[model samples]
Target: MAAVVTALVLLVFLAGYRFYARYVGRTIFKDDDPNFVTPAHEFSDGGDFVPTKRAILFGHHFTSVAGAAPIIGPCVAAYWGWLPALLWVVIGTVFMGAVHDYGALVVSAREKGRSVADIAAKVISPRVRLMFLVFIMVLSWLVLAVFAMAIAGLFMAIPTSVLPVNISIVVAVVMGWLLYKRGVPPLIPSLVALVLLYVFVYLGTKMPISLTDVGLDEAASSQTWIIGLFVYSAVASLLPVWLLLQPRDYVNSHQLVVGLGLLFLGLFVAHPNFDAPAVRMSEEGAPAMFPFLFVTIACGAISGFHGLVASGTTSKQLDSLEDARPIGYGSMLGEGALALASTMAAVAGISLVAACKLPGQGEVLDLSWAVYYDSWAHASGNKAAAFVLGGAAFLGKLGLSPLLAQTLMAVLVISFAATSLDTATRIERLIVAEIGEAVGVKALSNPIVATLVGIVPAYFLATAKISNGAGEAKEVAWALWPVFGASNQMIASLTLLVLALYFWQRKRPILPLLIPMFFVMVVTLISLFMHLVSFWTTKNWTLLAMTVVLVSLLLWMGAESLLAFTRGREQPDSGD
Candidate 1:
């Protein structure tokens, strides 16, 4: 009876969410003109501002924001039970994430297709833009560094995990390069690349590599990978969009859709119940339930990162103002759906007790999944579950065992780190160049010099961070996680502020933005303060360094934003 009621409630909630989003789409995004060509019509010079179809733009926006973090965070949170995690995912997405993502896109589009950085400068102030850019770059670096370590750890842990990712990256790059640079049709090459990637995935699983003997751990290895990745990112971001980010993201977007579909289907069929407590969180937890959940599940709930993607990339591609509603707003709902799907999977599959048993183990074990399957098998007393378990047991025969899955999962976990790292480097370089021009630093204006200055310092810092850790093989996950969460939530809160400002400017009800803004900010600030206090007491230099960067950046952003608003009110506006 309990299970039936729970299932029914979930069904209704998901159904309503989908319906509401669909209604939003029809009313706001449907195009009346049959002759309307998107990127073809709006502007066609193969630059940043080229327009695109709403559907394709939605693809871009969704893919950029959706990644492995959703899977990991929800799975971790599921240790408490599905109820709280699911609740937050739904509420945060509908109220917080969707609002920020959609609003950013609309606001950016209406302003003649400027990047968020530029928009911040105009709508807020230049100081705000500068501070926001710095924060973003730093946040980007942190993300990339952490993930690089994760990916490298996976490679060292089980070399076979590298097969699918490497093959996928290569296929994506080649396909994108051919399509955009050589004038080849994207459809054919993309399909071929995807097919090849899948083939590699299967083969890679069938034949795996073992690297446990390697000295590198998840933490140390990710730092090494970050250094290398940053150098590559520096080169990649500077290149034409078609070369790397777009094409790779295009392939990634499709994989995301397919992967998510398969994952959800499998979970639904399984329909496993979580065995964790309704409120299993500890008061002394580094990332405690209340505030930490908000940051950890940012994209799945409300990510500030989405705003950057919407304004920086997607808005420039919008064909009309109306398309913004669906592509921007609808994609957010889709991401929320994805988060819910993952949360459901975690809850349905894993037992809570097994998940809780991990921190004591002192390693990032693949606990959630193992427990879920084991429990379901125990409950049903099914031979099919036994076979699956046995298959996992023998996975080591091909080196495609549980360890390999962890390695692969960890690698995939940090893919965003690479994306954010070099992306940050480029943004920083741009800022430095702008500063140079502003202050008349003749040598600083040189792109080459600015690029070096930006990439070189971060590279060294990343290397030091990895080496200073407890051990080369021991991944330092606990220390940095809180800061990462706080940074992401801070961004989400800032975005909501932007939304509130926009509505306020137009004299519309600001509740939509204000409410979410307040919720995220309060939660995130609590998290930040807790993190700072914890690190300060411990005198952990590495954590202290990261906390300092985060606090300083956030403080500057706040001051700049307040001053901008004050200045705006003081100046005589077009509307008295």
Candidate 2:
């Protein structure tokens, strides 16, 4: 049954990519433009805007967007059930996420690689564009905060991951130097880098390093990791794309492919039965599946962040407009595949016994569906850890040593988080600079200052302590996760609106884009409302105020978009 389900999901994804995605690209995007000059070639600087091959760009785009969010979201949403999460991921990726990402890429490529918010200024009102940029900045900041703490939490939980995660950065610099500076062919050098990364992975398992081992307690170690991560982000943000960002993401993409392959192989071999319930009742203290499921599993299905990556960086490096389908649409499917694998791991690989055990508990618990769901429903701290534990368990079924398997899983999680952290920081820097230029703040227009402005708030947010209900304090990342989900989906909603308006002005078919736009706005608005109620009940004014602002922005954008639609105003000739 498990094998059949997995096979069906893969088949559906393949069919969608071949038929549906192709249809949307041809009919709606009108993707084949022989005369279209991509920005990478038009603005060739050998720096951030150099033309890149489809494969390398795909690798960079895929890894940047396939962060820990997809894994964590699906794992936590397993509280509702695996079936719902799986269905949403598969279907949403096809109809919603792929469309949004592909549209953003195509539109940005058409507009000289400006971001969606920048494009909004041409298609929508200037006021709408300002609000949209603010929305992107806030969303990117939360992403940086959440992902940094996520990587830190993983480091503390699985100390062996610390070595390989850091070493991969050095390996990326070497790969970049060989490929860009030395003008070496990519295939052999990238392969060599892959081998070197795993060599360190093995070494890390054998001689694990951790701040805790050096005498700091767990809390202190986590803070240290968070500090180190922000410092790395600041440096990475200032570097040329080819130097660190592109090469590092390229390596991480390969890591993702290998890790995903092993996970599916383990699934086929083990064929572990699904242990979690198919659905949870409303009485479980979890929000109903309607809106919550959509927000909870944002990336796997449809994420606004993909749009940022699409227009902000990917579009600038596109070799040709023709490659947008595979790089943009196809990457969303790749992320969906990862989300499905996470669901399988959580549902089948993690046994009830293991889920129920206390931290540091030594006894092995019995495997049962009921016990698994109950324990999973109540598991605490960085739900990503659950997926890591489950993935390690699945690999162990293939006869690997438990310690080795756990270390590999931890490395995978941390690497994904680190890739996202840097990418978000870079995007946030762009947003800050753009905002500064628009508002006449010359000081904030400096790249270094913009990068620091982006990182500092995220750092404080990640390290901020809040009461954990038992008198002890905890990192705010986990507490702010729901807010992140809502904000992320809100961005998706706004991006879709931009795309819809673009299509409307072009006199092309807008139904395909409009449907997803409407669906996402509805889901995001409701999710925010629910969060507002929760915050009000708990007297959490910070989140309450944030929610209010997001809701207001959504309404404001929605009203303006509606008026534009009703007016049927032609797009400015400048946009064309």
Candidate 3:
């Protein structure tokens, strides 16, 4: 019953978003005045901002948001039951992520493709700008650290993880050389690199790269990975976007579309019952809801992180105000769809396993329950379901036979993690450099020096694995969870805050900003309080560290907002 409802809801949501975005594209942006010179047009350069086809822009924007974090979050949160994760993905994306992303792009574009920090400074006040700057830097560092650890965890599980990643990187470098160095059109090498990437995943999975036996002390391994990822990010960020970022994105974009499509098609055909309960009530009688679920499923629903992407790169790529609706709002809808698919897979997988389990049997659902269930029941499903499920059931039934699908999933996730980690590191570097310059630290004004300084935190958090010990390593996951979620939520808050300011200053109806702003604030505050209480009660040093980081950030943001209020200014508008 729940499964049917979920499917219906997901379909309706996807279809509605498609209809709505098209309506917005046609009606709201009907003016189509190229000379009007909105922010995207204002900063128009042939490189990033020039009008490109919508398909290409969609590919770019989608890849920026599509990644393993969404899958991992859904999977983890589903342990509490699919209800929270599923409902949030639907509600939050529609109301929170979609609105925040679209709003950020529109606001940033209106401000001349300047960054969110810049807009905050120019329109709001220098103080607000500083807070945003600091937020960007700290958030970037934390994000880098989190993803670095995630990627390293994978590599640690399978040493051969490095092979596909290295191959993809090499392929990218070579493709960049061909397109940029040898003056070849991007399409040729881009396709080749992409094909080679899949081939590597296929072949590499069969090569027996499991290194679980040769464990590096978790701490040591984590530290090494953090430092290594920092160095990698520094180099990657410094490179021209054409070389690595753009090409990799091109490849990843296709992967997301194809991969997500396959998963959803399979889930529908399988129509597999969802075994997880509607809600998981904790033993203590708490609802096991609210703050925890909201924090856990941040990326799928309402990630503040999306604000950074919208305000940073996507804003720079918009061709005109018209593009903002699709690039921002449309892309978020895609993410929401992905989240729904993941939740379906989790539920279906869980259901299949629980049904087959014998009475008094040992626990049926382990951490890898989805993998196990898909391995068995995919082949056991009704002929109709199996046939309808298409390639998903075929792949699922294949188990470790083809090995390619598993490898593909693994490589896709790892590469996404690597790219995101590096990107975060670069953003941090830029933030530190900008902030240092603002504070008159002339010596730290060098981007490279600021980047190096930024890397320090990455190294520290990454290496904290060893120093904290194996036990501590696992615990940090929980402690850091809310901080990561809150940081992302705060980003959303700041974005909606900016949008509200924009509307307020312009005397436009402020309901859009007010709606999302209120929700994010409530959720984030609830999540933050839970985290603080958890940290203080446990007296865990890792949690303690995260608490300090959050506190300091809040303080800085408060001061910055106070400064903005004092300034009593309105952003200058050059009417188009």
For all predicted structures, in order, the TM-scores are 0.77, 0.95, 0.82
Which model scores highest in lDDT?
2
User: Candidate 1 residues 269-357, lDDT tens each?
Assistant: 44455444555553332345667666666667887777877776676677776676667666766676556655554544343112222
- Model 1 spans with C-alpha error above 4 angstroms: 1-47, 53-56, 181-185, 206-224, 283-287, 351-454, 466-478, 539-549, 552-556, 559-576
Looking at candidate 3, what is the lDDT of residue 238?
A: 70
- What candidate 2 gets wrong by more than 4 Å, as runs, is 352-369, 375-382, 466-474, 569-576
Candidate 3 stretches with Cα past 4 Å from truth are 1-10, 19-33, 36-54, 158-161, 177-189, 208-224, 285-287, 351-394, 397-402, 465-478, 540-572
Query: Relative to the unseen true structure, what is the C-alpha lDDT of residue 559 in candidate 2, on a scale of 0 to 100?
Result: 84
Which pairs of residues collide in candidate 3? 219-465, 219-466, 223-463, 304-488
Cα shift from native, residue 304, model 3 (Å): 1.6
> Model 2, 94-205: lDDT tens per residue?
9999899999999999989998888988777888888988888877877898888888877877778888888899989988898888998888878888888888888888
Candidate 3 colliding pairs, count: 4
Lowest summed lDDT across 10 adjacent residues in model 2 is found at 352-361
- Top candidate when judged by TM-score against the true structure: 2
Candidates sorted by TM-score, best first:
2, 3, 1
**Ranked by lDDT, top first:** 2, 3, 1
Per-candidate clashes, comma-separated = 7, 0, 4
